[model samples]
Target: MRILISLCLALGGLLSLPAFALSDSGQQALGQLQTRWAEIRYELPEKQREAAFAGLAKEADQALASEPKAAELLIWRGIILSTWAGAKGGLGALDLVKQARASLEQALAMDPKALDGSAYTSLGSLYYQVPGWPIGFGDDEKAEAMLKQALALNPKGIDPNYFYGDYLLRQKRYAEARAALETALQAPDRPGRELADKGRREEARALLAEVRKKLE
Candidate 1:
């Protein structure tokens, strides 16, 4: 269950950059992707969400095509593809996860600090969420390294804190996980992300409650 939750990290709204600062087309692309992300995470039924995310993946591809070297665009595209892979599920989604990883790697190469280090967050989540053997390329060590870098880059961002907390929880580092989640709960809200912020805060609260119980 926790793995499933972690796979849907896109719902946490990792893109912390203000939309107003983006180019008009970039803003529009992000807006569209976020809307589809919300629909996949909240509104759509489990069976239908995969198709919804597939459509969003196409949109993300178009955005990346227009701004091939834009780190911001690459980050968003990675987010979309990651969410799409989560929705698709099973071994069939392996390719999508790989694509997401590649997109994030490109974004990192172009600008590791773009969108508040969101590419690292997303890539780290993918590394931990996918299978580790013949099935996929997951690596807990790599995930931890990447997530720590993300947190270092964006210590106060809700997404990084929550993700690191989730990673710690999965590793049974309950005390550290609880602390990270608590920090995530205290993160300030972004101007245009009220819905995403509210949703993520609720998730953090719930996870923190679970960690508290475990610590007890």
Candidate 2:
């Protein structure tokens, strides 16, 4: 009787568990997006990149549709749209950038700590990289604040450090930029992210060279 009672108690506990966390299918979708994004960002030729990003955007859209409030899905969608804008530059790209900004904003609202604070890093990059008044909503102060928040959340993360470094370089804070870039270069590799790690490290090295020139 005691054994049977314990079994029922365990079953009751299992049944009471919350379902707010990501489903297995949602996790799988996020992994697929990461893999495909890395391939598009690192392996695809420049002429083919925009088309690839369009496909990624579609995949992200589907993933979000399946799990509308999934913070990770929203973050990936934002990233896909942002990269698509960069690949499809011109007046047309402005709309894509706006959409990307909105997606990231929503993700931030949902879960600011999701994906190691990736939403903050990407949004910060957009703020500094885009145009200012009359064209876009770029603002150095906003960018600085977002990037600093991202760094605070993920002090040792590669993307946050690299982006912060790039922003510093653009602001002509060469010394600080170089320091951040160096830290990015030393970041640990993530599983299933070999291509991304290689590409980002190369970018950091290239930018570090430019920073060195400015210092000299």
Candidate 3:
């Protein structure tokens, strides 16, 4: 959990705008995953998150098995796995992150712009959050590049901006972080995602408060 403070604190929502290519079955499966994921992520107790996310990750895996070609499902799977790893924590979490990275990369290869470039958002978060060198493939440069690409694709997206701002805050670029986070706060509400939007705004506000303190 501590390993992903930057991301968890910054995560708006991994479930992105609909992908037109998704089959009816895949869309249904993704909807179920989306609703459950949000509930577990925002409403579940901290102690229960590891189990909840772990179970959901497996469900995501199952969903992908039925629609191996759906980039949206794969992206969500990556997000679920990444958050699962965060909730699990410790040496055991390494394998989950690796799997998450693989899923995101596959989604990017399948469709770089799928889900409003959500694969980029998840991948960027993982790159910076995971360890580097012998431990994992975490790279600051790669993270920044991927994040910037996400921003280019969806400048008004809450997740990309929040994650980028979080990354900037981590890099000690407080002023830029504040600007990015403020942009996140200004993102328009996403219809049918009021809960997620509320949660994301709360996160952005919390992080913005931190950024403001740094500015002072």
Candidate 4:
């Protein structure tokens, strides 16, 4: 009887092992997909951005359905939707924005600290971009709060820093914007490295030049 019980326990463990391995594999694949998505977004031509993001959004949707509670998948979905909305333009974009916000909110509710507050960063940027009317959607105060929460979670994250810096620059808070942009520029992550080194380099340099002009 003792030997039989031991064998049963061992068999149970073996049965469960595959599930654990599969979950780990799924998580790793999601991470790789995210990295690739970010890299391609920066490298791809402007005209191609929409189609690329749509493809990613479809993948993310399938992944989310497969792992309903996966915070990472939800975050990726939100990112893709937000990008899609941005690419398409006009009020038609609001539907995608709302979808992105819902997904991010679900992600945050599932795990507030997931992905180093990535959900918060995405939500913050979304709010910052929306207009502040009854239907428009922008809220500067909420954007600032969310961005600050993200920074608290991961001070080195590039998205929060870059978006917040852009907000400050728009507000003509040059000093603060410069500090935030510089921090974003110095981030060690893939998104930061790609943005600062590629698409945004010229823009950032021009902004810095403008700052110097204002100072002089």
Candidate 5:
């Protein structure tokens, strides 16, 4: 009788070990995914970005399934889909964009303040990148508002700073763009910061050179 009892307890413990290991592994995987996502954000080429995003999407889906209530996984999934849309182009892009939007919405609903306002930053970029008007998608005003909110949440976050600078540059507000870009370039360990800094400085110099030409 005692032998049987011992055997049952061992079996139960063995079964429980897998569950505990899986839970810990899932958390670790999620952390690695976030770090990889950040590192790849600026390194990926336009063509390669789609493939990378697809991989990220797959990993995120697996993580979400394993931990259904993980809001961070949802946010990562949304970011991957959104980036994929940008890479793919055409009507298919629109579909991915919609998916991305929904995923981010789900993330926000799960946790309004997940990952330092990352969801808001994603939405802001979506609005800024998509076309405006009858074609549907894109809203510069909305983009500005969302990005501002993200900044409010994470005043020194790299993404909001870089994107906001790009927005200003598009408006040809040279001085403002320069200021914002400078701040973005200075942001700690921001992916592609050095490259972006070089690009922005070159742009500023060229713009100033043009002004000089005109004055001359």
Candidate 6:
């Protein structure tokens, strides 16, 4: 259950970037991918998520076939792959995560600022969440740097702040975690993202409650 929720980390809401290169059909494809991802992550039952995410990943892959150079599409593909890996947790999922990391890295190289720096946010979350050393590629130092870069790009974005706060909480940095979650709560509502904003605020509030318990 925790993994399910954590998988949603670092996914920015309703792209705020202009995404100048995507055509009308590409934009529509992106929207479908986003809508489907949100539905699978937030609305689907936990037991059913693995299959759902697998399906979505295939859909995203098919979309990418046409718009291979679209950075935003690549980001969504990475996001879907990450969530799918979470849903299918175990050694078998490592390949999916690796693919996700590679896709996000490619997206970053193509457009670091795309989707409001979501590539950085997602990549950062992966760094902290995956196991380190021989088991996986996780590294706390790299996580912090990537997350901070994401925050620098979108200072007031809810997703970046929430992810940063979550990472801080994992490090037992309660005060900093609380501050970041508070900022997430205070983040402005993004246009066309009412559902994501509301859901994220609730998550921030839940984490804030946990952080307050630590402070107490």
The TM-score leader among the candidates is: 6
Rate residue 186 of model 6 by lDDT: 91
TM-scores across all candidates? 0.90, 0.90, 0.91, 0.79, 0.71, 0.93
Residue-level lDDT of model 6, residues 82-158, one tens digit each, is 98989898777788888999999999888888988999999998999987778788899999999999999898889
Two-way TM-score contest, 2 vs 5, winner: 2
Clashing pairs in 1: none
Query: Which candidate should be chosen as best, given lDDT against the real structure?
Result: 6
Give residue 63's lDDT in candidate 5 (0 to 100). 86
Per-residue CA lDDT of candidate 2, range 1-216, in tens?
A: 111000000000011112235688987888888888878887888799889989989999998898998877887887888888888877677787789889989988987878777788888888888777787788999999998988887887788889889999989999999999999998877777777788888888999999999999
lDDT of 3 by residue, 25-136 (tens): 8878877877777787788898999999889888998988888889888888888888888888877888889998899999998888887788888999988899887777
Model 5 lDDT at residue 155? 68
lDDT by residue (tens digit), candidate 4, 1-216 = 111000000000011222113367566656655655655556677688778777878888877777887776777788778877776667677778889889999988887677677787888878778666676567888888998998897775555676667777767888888887777667654532343245444445556567656656
What is the RMSD, in Å, between candidate 1 and the native fold over all Cα?
A: 3.3
- lDDT of the candidates, in the order given: 0.80, 0.78, 0.82, 0.66, 0.60, 0.85
- Across 79-116, the per-residue lDDT of candidate 1 in tens digits comes to 87787778777667788888889989988988788778
How far residue 171's Cα lies from its native spot in candidate 1, in Å, is 0.4
| CA error at residue 11 for candidate 6, angstroms | 3.7
Deviating ranges (above 4 Å) for candidate 2: 1-20
TM-score, ranked from best to worst:
6, 3, 2, 1, 4, 5
Q: Is candidate 3 or candidate 5 better by TM-score?
A: 3
Question: Candidate 3, 131: how far from true, in Å?
Answer: 1.5
Query: How many pairs collide in each candidate, listed in order?
Result: 0, 0, 0, 2, 0, 0
